[model samples]
Target: MRSDVQQQIISIIAREAVLEPEDVQPSMTLDELGLDSLGLVEMIFAIEEAFDISVPFNANEPAQSEFDISSVGAIIGAVERLICGQRPEIVA
Candidate 1:
């Protein structure tokens, strides 16, 4: 189940991606959401402002950062971990 935080993030992403909230799903990748690099960066900024959390995201190289942007679910999980004040473990 998606947490309230996750839902908020989804809402932000949906708004930024210019898609309906119902179209945003955990399984969908940013590419699938039609987010270009600029859109992704904007979404990150919106999320940071919305959550009042510093997202350690590097849009240029997401795979190399502590932040994960592989999919909606990954983003939600990373945000949840950050909200819990824990660093996300690097998944192999």
Candidate 2:
């Protein structure tokens, strides 16, 4: 069962990807969803706004950023951590 947080994150990603929220999956990568650099940046902005938290993401160097963007589940986990006032584990 998807938590409220998970569902909200999926909705944000789906909007950016021009997909239905149900079509977005935790295991899916943003690339797989056809999100380019611009789309990715927009998605991040939406996430931050919706959650009322700052996301540590750098579109140019996503892999080097503190927030993980490797997969949908990673993003949700990171946001969840942020909402709980915890720092995200640095993605390696």
lDDT, candidate 2, equals 0.88
Lowest summed lDDT across 10 adjacent residues in model 2 is found at: 83-92
List per-candidate RMSD values in Å.
5.0, 5.0
What are the clashing pairs of model 2?
none
- Write down the lDDT of every candidate, Cα atoms only: 0.85, 0.88
Candidate 1, residue 71: CA error in Å? 0.4
Tens digits of lDDT, candidate 2, 1-92: 99777899999999999999999989999889999999999999998888778988888888899999989999998889887874333221
Q: Write the per-residue lDDT of candidate 1 for residues 1-92, one digit (tens) a residue.
A: 76668789999999989999889999999999999999999999998887777899887788899998999999988888786774233221
Model 1 TM-score on a 0 to 1 scale = 0.87
Give candidate 1 misplaced runs (Cα > 4 Å). Answer: 86-92
**Candidate 1 at 24: error in angstroms?**
0.7
